[model samples]
Target: MPLTVHQFPCLEDNYGFLARDEATGLAACIDTPEAGAILKALDTLGWKLDLILNTHWHPDHAGGNAEIKAATGATIVGPAEVTRISALDREVKGGDVVMLGETRFEVIETGGHTLGHIAYFDAADAIAFVGDTLFALGCGRLFEGTAEQMWTSLQRLAALPDETTVYCAHEYTASNARFALSVDDDPALKARADHIFALRERGEPTVPTSIGLEKATNPFLRAPRLAERVGVAGEPDYKAFGAVRAAKDVFKG
Candidate 1:
C-alpha cells in the first residue's frame, strides 16, 4: 500500500508532514516544526503517530520532539546530531532503513545545512522527505558543512529517479525563484517562476516539487551549467555551486 502524506503549513514558513502507511495505518511525522500544530493535526485525523522523524537538530525541526513524544508516545528517530537539541530513540544514518509498519524509509546522508542532516526516501512510493537540504529552486546554505559536502549531498539526491516526488520542509519557492532568475535565463525556469508567482498570488503552497522539475530549473542544481554567469568559469562543479550559493546568500531579491 502507498504512504498517505498529510501536509500542513506550520510555524511562520515551515511545513509539517504526517505520513501514514495505508497498509498498516502507522504514521510518522517527518519533522517537528510545531508541536501544537502537529498534535492538532493528529487529533483531527485520528491517526496514531508511531514515529517522530528528525532531519536535523535545528530548533524548528526537532524542538517539538519532547512535546509530541509526550503526547503520543511515538518513538523519535533521526541522526545522532539530534541529541544536541532533544532526545533520540533511534540514531539512523545513510544506508539505514526505518520501517513504519510495512512502509520503509531509506535514510540518505544529506549533511550540508547541518553536519548531520539527513533525508528519508521511500523508493516504493518515489517520495522523499528532504529537510532543509534541497529546496524547489535552491539548496540549503552551507551552515556547518563545506561547499563540496553540500554539492556531493545534492548529487546523491539528484541521482534518484527523475520522477521522485520531493517534499521539502519549507515554503521559500517565491523568493528562491526570484534569485534564480537573476542568475539563469533558462526559459523553463522563467515559466516555472511565473507559475510559482501565480500560485503564491492565489495563496497556494509551492512545495512537493518533483526531482525532475528541480533538476531542469533549480539554479543550484544547474550551477555547473552556469559557471561563467556566476563567475566560476573553469572551476570545479562544487566551486560553481559554491559561487551560486554565495550569490544567493546576499541576493536582495
Candidate 2:
C-alpha cells in the first residue's frame, strides 16, 4: 500500500513531512525542522513519530532532532554526517534501505547542498523526500559540493519515474518561478509560472512538484538547454549547470 504522507509548513518556509506506513501504522518524520511544529502535526494527525529521517546535517533540517527524539523517543536515522550537527540512532548512506512498516525507502546519495546529503525514494509509493537537493522549479544551492557534484546528484533524481512526487524541503517555488520565467520562453513554462504566482498570492504551497514537471521546467535538470536559453550554448554540461547555479545565487527574483 502507498504510504500516507502529510506535509506541513515548518519554521519559515521549510516543510516537515510525516509518512505513515499503512500496513504497520509506523510513521516517520522526514526531517526535524522544528520539534514543536512536528509534534503538533503528529498530535493533530493522531500518528506517533517512530523515526526521524534526516537528509543532511544542516541546522534547519536537523535543529529539532534532539528535542523531537526526547519527546517521542523516535529512533533517529540519517547519514552518518548528521552526528556532526545532532544526535542520531542509526546512520545510513547510499544504497541502504530504510523500512517504515512494509514501505521501503531506497536511499540515494545526493551530495551538493551538503556533501553528505541523501534522498529517500519509495518506488512503490512513487514518492521522494528530496530534502534541499531539488525543489519546485529550482534546485538547492551548492554549498559544500561543487556544481558538478550537484549536477550528478540531480541527474540521479531526474532518473526517477516521471510520476514520482518530489517532497523538497523549502517553499521556494515563487522565487524559482520568477527565475525560470527570466530564462525560459516556453509557453508551457510561462503557464506553470503564472499558476505558481497565483497560488502563492492565495497563500498556497507549490511544492510536491512532479518529476515530469520538473524535467520540463526546472533549469537545473535541463542543463543542456540552459546555456542556449541564456545565450551560452557552447559550454559543457557542468559549465552550463554552474552558470545556472551562479545566476540563481545572485538572482533577486
Candidate 3:
C-alpha cells in the first residue's frame, strides 16, 4: 500500500507533513516545524505517530521533537546532527533504510542547508520528504556547507526518478519563481511561473512538486545552461550553480 501524506501549513511559511503507511496504519512526522499544529493534525486524523523523522537540526525542523515526543512517545529518527537540538532515538545516515510499517524509506544524504541534512525516499511509492534541501524552483542556501556541496546534494535529488513526488518543507515557490524568472528566459519556466503565481493568488499551496517538473523548470537545476547569465560562463556545472546561488542571495527582485 502507498503512504498517505497530509500536508499543513505551520509557523511562517513552513509546512508540517504527516505520512501514514496505509498497510500498517503507522504514521511519522517528516519534521516538526510546530508542535501544536502537528499534534492537532494527528488528533484530528486519529492517527498514532510512530516516528519523528528529522532532516536536520534547524530549529523549525526539529525544534518540536521533545514536545511531540512527550505528547506521543514517537521514536525519533534522523541524522546524528539532530542531537545538536533535539533527542534522536535512531541515527540514520545515507544508505540506511527506515521502515514505517511496511513502507521503507531510504535515507539520502543531502547535506547543504545543514551539514547533516538528510532526505527520506520511499521508492516503492515514489515519494520523498526533502527537508530544506531542494525546494520548488529553488534550492537551499549554503548555511553550513559549500556551493559545491549543495550542487552535489541537488544532483543526488535530481537523479531520482522523474516521476518521484517531492515533498519539500516550505512554501517558497512564489518568491523562488520570481527569482527564477529574473535569471532564466526559458518559456517553460515562464509558463510554470505564471501557473505558480496564479496558485498563490488563489491561496493554494504550490508544493508536492514532481522531480520531472523541477528538473525542467527550476532555475537552480538549469544553472549549468545559464552560466553566462549568472556570470560563470565556461565554468563547471557546480561553479555555475554556485554563481546562481550567490545571485539569489542578493536578488532583490
TM-score of each: 0.99, 0.98, 0.99
Model 2 global lDDT (CA atoms, 0 to 1): 0.92
| Candidate topping lDDT | 1
Model 2: per-residue lDDT, tens digit, 1-253?
7799999999899999999999888999998998999999999989977899999999999989999999899999999889998988999999999998899999999999999999999999899999999999999989899998999999999999999999999999999989988877778889999999999999999988999999998988887787976666897787798888888899986
Stretches of candidate 2 exceeding 4 Å from the true structure: none
lDDT of each: 0.96, 0.92, 0.96
- For candidate 3, lDDT tens digit of each residue in 1-253? 9999999999999999999999999999999999999999999999999999999999999999999999999999999999999878999999999999999999999998999999999999999999999999999999999988999999999999999999999999999999999999999999999999999999999999999999999989999999998888999999999999998999998
TM-score of 3: 0.99
Better of 2 and 3 by TM-score: 3
Runs of candidate 3 with Cα error greater than 4 angstroms are none
Best-to-worst order by TM-score is 1, 3, 2
Q: Please, what are the lDDT tens digits per residue for candidate 1 over residues 104-150?
A: 99999999899999999999999999999999998988999999999
After superposition, the stretches of candidate 1 with alpha carbons farther than 4 Å from their true spots are none
lDDT of 3 at 205: 97
